[model samples]
Target: MSDKSKTQDEDLPYYDHPTGGWGSVKSLAKIIARSRPDPGIMQTLWRQNKPGGHMCTSCAWAKPDKPHTFEFCENGAKATAWDLTSHRCTPDFFAEHSVEALKSWSAHDLEMAGRLTHPMRYDADSDHYIETTWEEAFEGIAAELKQLDPKSVVFYTSGRAALETSYLWALFARLYGHNNLPDSSNMCHETTSVGLKKVIGSPVGTCKLEDFNECDMIMFFGQNTGSNSPRFLHTLQAAARRGCHIVTFNPVRERGLIGFANPQSPMQMLTSSRTKISEHYLQVKPGGDIAVLAGLCKRVLELEEEKNGGVLDKAFIEEHTTGFEAFAQSMQQTSWADIEQASGLKRTDLEIIAGMYANAKKTIGIYGMGLTQHVHGFVNLAMYVNLLLMKGHIGRFGAGISPVRGHSNVQGQRTVGISEKPELVPLDKLAEMFDFEPPRDEGRTTVEVVRGVLDGSVKAFLSLGGNFARAIPDQGQADPAWKDLTLNVQIATKLNRSHLLVGRKTWLLPCLVRSEEDMQATGPQAVSMEDSLSNIYGSVGKRKPAGEHVKSEMAIVAGLAKATLKPNPKVKWDDWLGDYSLVRDLIEETYPDDFKDFNARMFEPGGFYRGNPARERQWKTESGKAEFTAPKVLTALGELPGEGQYTMITLRSNDQFNTTVYGYTDRLRGLEGSRYIVLINPKEMADAGLSEGQMVTLESAVDDGVERRVADLKVTAYDLPDGCVATYYPEANPLVPLEYHDQESKTPAYKGVPVRIVA
Candidate 1:
């Protein structure tokens, strides 16, 4: 390493030491500085999850049935530690801190205040949030909603909302006569749903955890299962021990892909022995996934043609799919030179990967945000499906396309119809069931919702969960749009940056966390979540109430509906909220063939698996087969900066999830105490004559002039690809222009933002 690069590493908070293990003592200090932990809250949190009552809702991964030994991960602990805080945002507290003053505070400082004690409203004159009665808050919101055109209202659902509440909210929106539903999914995995549906006729993954054990080769693309989905580590370790070939392709050399210490394995944990995960690691350039996937498909076709005179599942392709010839022709036209240059991979590496697929009997392709958060996200996903189809890798155990979701119920939310654009069949069924006309017009997506708010077309914003302002990109634009809203309602458990960005008239309604006991008229309620594998399971909170006034998310949604649309007798929102089973009954009515015995199935230890058409190789397309989409011309890749500017991909630290910053420590990347540094290659730093650890500024290279410039950012030299740098999200989100999104998926190209570094 160059002296400058070595200097940069030495200046990092944790240097090159691992985050956990003996280095934890120093890691803890860094965490304290970054998280700004409150002592009183830590004490209360420590007392939580004691022998009897409940577990922390935020860290539900702790196996409740097992011994209390393994309770949380570092990030999970931080979440609980933050929540158990003693600080309260009382009316007096708000009185002292003006909204303007609070805006200037860091996101960490604003959220450190435990929770909102009572309902509050944005008082423009006082420039603070004043506590108000629940009745007045509800009445004010109801009156404003009643005055606006129902279509002008946008309902936003965050991943944090419970199944019961999400269902009620969706129902309320439909009854209110609008389909303008925008949620967290739009910003994350909207591409997963769109692409999967087009290829397999189902939005969910086909493989289950059980299939993970049966697979011969597991190809993980664009996912860091260790940090994003740690629970899968055990499964991957087991598969590796069983001699399964594990291939991982990602821009970052994730520690999890290198290996993992199974916490459950007594012998391994005692010895600190780690299991090898990936047999092969391919570091594809950011935004180069499409070319890589296309290359894989091209090689697969050649192998089929040479070995078996075109053995590519001709029967399945001819009978079930559309546009295969066009797709195949496009693949053939992609020259190896272009593929190698675009994908940052040589011909030999791709051939080895192709050979692995050819030899393996069963293969599974799993991916996460790296594939979805791009300009051609949908096309990239479709190419994966195409490769799987080429090898006849569908409809079998351990073989399918699995998009690992972040939040537990993210997939379930979509499964239960939390979409802006409802399918024709579901829409028709909903209209028939409610005895009212369902809106035919498609609603605005997340990006569109923000645009609508800016243009004054949207009147009300009702978010079920999530810190919207902090989660979205181009904050310079999104922040102002949020403030322009006439009414902004947030149904949440804790205060966050979104709450601080209060609108003209706002209501902060506190709700129950998922890990807390939710008591309704029918008694204690149990919710269900569908994991990434499409296995539905029951999740019951065993913890006591944080406060008596805290209402379940379902009850809050029902209450809001009762106050706003109770006069309209067409919908029975009250009946459904009374018992969660009733909501399941409604789901049964909507998807009768699939959810026929919803209540009965949910009672089972591991809930029943939803039928996946792809699992059976049953493609429900126009031709009743899995269709192939032709690849677009590789012209856009030329648009990226090649000379002076470099592309900066924004990513989350292992310590953070979405917009929720648990702490400042990134164990794998050797980062600690701060999240403002950018990772760059030593060669690039030297070529630019830049000194390590020197503060620098970044400006967008795109012609849109979105003005996303990060100033005084510390530079850290690391083993990154040339012409590429990386920084943490939300902080780097400003560098991404809303217009610079996937043309097909509308997902912000958060992974490949072209930027210029300044001294």
Candidate 2:
């Protein structure tokens, strides 16, 4: 091999700088050109971050405390511009391209094709989507539902769903006599929801935006804050300035965690001054989070023994915790050798970090998919909670747990009754409020929905804004199962791959983007949203509609409810559609304690924060206390794939959000030109006798009778952890086995999957 090529193989390109620099500005400009050409677009775009205006159509990271003129990050701008793009995908566009022809288009190509302007249905003979009237579309769906058992229909919602729409979406399904309400939550934060409820008494975070100003230390476990939530860099930068010790534990040295240059500040932008983040970083192995935390706990316990419980909060633990004795006993049994090997860290490294944790009285723990998308995701989360619990750090100002959610409304969707298994017990109140009998049985989850489709129990699939087929695990299984469905319908603003993954029949109903104006029977209407911190607020779109045919998400849901539940007159669907305040009134009546005068509170400046009970040290758990869970270590990682195998982590490009691809380049990661590439450790490449530009086929170790292989991926040597390789997901999603998921939460294990590379 040539010397230059060898060096290139040893490293993927590096920026040697912090994230959120000039590169973000360039990205924002390019996305604007694709979305629209109107000069007034800029004026409308600026309103996205204004208080009393629409929330950013991207990540739900900000606290919504004080309103800023320029509140949006670069990614947020990209999302809004992409949504408000002037390009139109009218009936003519669909008629020109066949389903087979459209399949060849890349993700970017599909998005650039423009926004869908009307409702459409797949014609069996033509193999093309044909335009239909809204009445005809709703009637067709009602006819399909009339033939099947109510249990046979699966209703799914994406995180982009608004709070107002979500409440209506759930009521419609229950009024239809079933609760088959599966949502995106089941695949992502179900572990955080289930695990945290056991420990902290609340599924949401224990702290609010104001807490960032108080914490002495911030521990980022597995999440990449820079790329995922660029706006959060401001918070980290400010905290760093205040002498907060920022520690990061991840397999990759994410640039965002390293440092950040705030684009908003004129001085920082002109001077090119960057703020350093992550005072301490631990390169923990994939699936090694629990081990690393356990090692820290062991050292803390050892100190407590030496100082006679001086290291732990005896007063807090005695009054507010349960099962500490069992949890502590388990920590003592974990050997240092096992911790070192599993975590890929030295005992001294663990001790040093533990000492820092012990010294900090007020700390915040934040994590993302790295800890959630695993077989032991629930316990993976519980371990961090365990450490914080021992310190009595939770349920206090500046100290709590934060699971940074992916979607803007993923948490809000669940909050407003879009859950498969409804969070509130005794559905009688909800039933009484809506004047209908609610289903008692728990509904199917996102994972269970797929199983239901495969087994023929689910004959129909209806979604509100998500690329369900591409986002879900096991395309090898899910794609075919979808084809077997009696009907598939999607309510969306843009065309996605899920709309193309057809069942016996498919339909696409165009809807309004949050950036576009929504005018109902009333003059103008606004939708409310809840941010990642559970801050509720009203957001009204200032721009004109992308297309006149496109309706608001709430309007669509109300129309569907009116047509389907014609049998029930108790629901004043027409009135709810005319005045959204009526819908909010019902929410207050149903969840009186949580949503007292919900309609009136929405008009407040910067909206409102629905406070967490756990923040006040209230434990709603079965024990009426913050319960401690014993960590369960993985006994055996599946066998290695012969001689050339490695663990695989499915990743998102810096240019992408979830399954939405804004561009082909992962600018933050220094990759360009292509998406079908894999990053491997230099030592792993040497041992496997592989070099750069070499082609390899990746296959999952655990197959479900169907052959799962992603072929001809270009390999490059990266500085990833030993024996671990990484690739962008949706491309690598084919390699994720269908049944390989967490036992408790059923979230697919996207990280640390055993795989073999075919040379």
Candidate 3:
């Protein structure tokens, strides 16, 4: 840890103003100045999130049917500037910095160096990357891939991939005879998909952009809107002004939930007036969401009895749901003492929130990674869904559950069948279309892939666009395992730490980012992205390609498929590359009900919503009704923190998105210059014999620990629940063991890891 001055201590001045306003404007200006992006950056910014322009590459919040002239937010601009940066990591730069030397660079510095300009191949002897032609690169990759068993290969997709690219990737995987298609969703929202699909018959959220307008009450669980989804702040601010009840449950009192000042509001910015969000804020303990939700359901049941059958929609419940009697009995049996202890909240506080929920005719529950990155993440989601079901809150105009996804097109990737589970995709339909028998066995997920790599079971790994090694849990164990792979392929727009984790034969393939125009034989092309809501939009880049050598992601996958797969009469990889609409046609054919008129509907203004059957009261579950789950355990950790230990909740800073560190400063939390400091409750710090600015190490308290620890972390005091600590992610990722994850979904317990701070 650095000195007090360098550490950006807790004593630093707090950001008292609202989330947006001048703070956002200045931050965007600084990023643009620092990146010195291409001349077309201004035009690109103007077109972003508009009807016919490129999608914002940050969060997947839905764009309104009538979007603003400028729909991009501060972080969205940062993502765009990141992609459009003038700095180029050309062949000469790679020649100067050896792979070993680049490995030492900070995550932010590695990306800030610039966009990759050409295809490169790793020179194992020299430990440097040398420029290579795309032809040679694909040929080498194809030759090695042909030798490997399909089950040994993992096709990893990042949220950066568009619907077109993701569909092609899945097609290539199945056509080549494997189902090992793990994606970024495995790390974040896999729990949502697993939990919701079992209960609601749909993996996606039910709410649309219009729902926000009509929703009477909105409850946010562990979602930070300001940093993660800034554009959505406009919607929140409007809801607040309309007098909608906004409740929040989180470990930290995030600035986004407290209040927001829309940067786009001229009068609000001029007067410095802010829309106060969160009518009520509850600081729940880490891994306590299930308990809190159960408590609310219990209270709602109590209110229902008090009101004599007026509180719950009994008719809807009886007709549209199953297992209510058992679920209600489980809630009734739940003791308040247990709920209070697990949630770190009072009975009165929960009752008050429950009262508000009962009064609201329609409600929407929004959440993010905080709720999904836990051991009981599946149950956490199920419990939330149960609460909505109790009141018939779903399948209506303004009522449903929304899991705010991170990445732009993560949901889109999965929608296009980028899943590891063979059962999730329409394998039979795909086989009929492509004339190849697809693999029926379940394949490796993100964590399974890591284990496979380490055990020498996985020989080839192809990443469509993510920092896989860094994003996954237990980097200490997973990072070096990449070298054991026979081949590693990264298709990206820029350099990151994951690119440096070279295998026996590695290839860095540069591709066109979302901001850059993608042209093919069919003329200028547009790719589609599905938002957190099920709405799909066609996005066409306004700017030219970063480099002439760079190709579209779809094109890259097509080339790889042509080179790797034996010639098949039915699958024309090149023809699909020439016209992405052809890919959409096949996708529509694969999932006819969801993607009817896919090509035409995708280009519509604000795209089109692929309506979820669950939202229309059509449950696709086994019983043909919304199924209720009665979890044996009511908490994510299954227990509260023991003495001498605190639950650590890993999070992202305002400056960073996911594992991509744009800068070290977390201005939203009133900290800058460093992200290595952990925020602990002041009393907890005192109890642990630690003071502000003190250097400490956090050791995992798990019994199966193989010395999992993060050393030299500076401790800072903050307002958090007792026995609960907070730290930035990727840095804190090591403390979470790979085996410690949701039992059902396999999503790593990143939000609730038991750790003790050592001075």
Q: Which one is best on lDDT?
A: 3
Error of 1 at 406 (Å): 1.1
Reference-based TM-score of each model? 0.91, 0.97, 0.98
1-759, model 3: which lDDT tens digit per residue? 111123233554457778888998988888888889998888988988888889988999888878787888999999999889988989999999999999888998999889888999999999999999999999999999999998899899899899988998998998887889989899999999998898999998889888899999999998989899999899998999999999999988788888788888889888888888888888898888888999999999999999888999998899999999999999999999999988989999999999999999999999988888888888888899999999899898899999999999999999889998888898888888988888899989888998898899999999999899888988888887889889999999889989999999999999998988888998999889999998899999868787889988988999899999999899988799898899899889988887999988886777798889988999999899998888678788833578898898997988898888888668887788777888887767777888888888998888784888888888878778888888888899988888888888899889999888888
Candidate that beats the other on TM-score, 2 or 3, i.e. the better one = 3
TM-score, predicted candidate 3 vs. hidden true structure? 0.98
Lowest lDDT 10-mer window, candidate 1? 59-68
- Residue-level lDDT of model 2, residues 357-468, one tens digit each, is 8889898999998988888888888889889988888987898999898888888877878877755544888776657678888888777888887788989998999888
Candidate 1 runs further than 4 Å off: 1-87, 308-315, 566-570, 634-638
Every candidate's lDDT: 0.73, 0.82, 0.88
User: Candidate 3: which stretches are off by over 4 Å?
Assistant: 1-13
For 1-759, candidate 1 gives per-residue lDDT tens digits of 111223234443332322233343344345555545445434434434333323333422222222335434444455654544445667788888888888786666676666656777888888888888877877888899888899889998876565556667787898887888777778888888877887778776778667777899999888877566665665677799999999988887776677676554577656756677788888888878887888888888889878975457777676666778889999999899988888888889998998788788889988888888887788778888888877677777878888887765777677777888766238888777878777777888878887787788988899887887777778777777777788899887667888877788888887766555788778888776665676555556645555666677787787788888856565776677777888888887887766768888764433567778778878876667787887784422325776899878887877776777766667766676678888887878989888778899988888874567888788887766667899888888878887777776577778878899988
For candidate 3, give the lDDT.
0.88
Q: Is candidate 1 or candidate 2 better by lDDT?
A: 2
| Winner by lDDT between candidate 3 and candidate 2 | 3
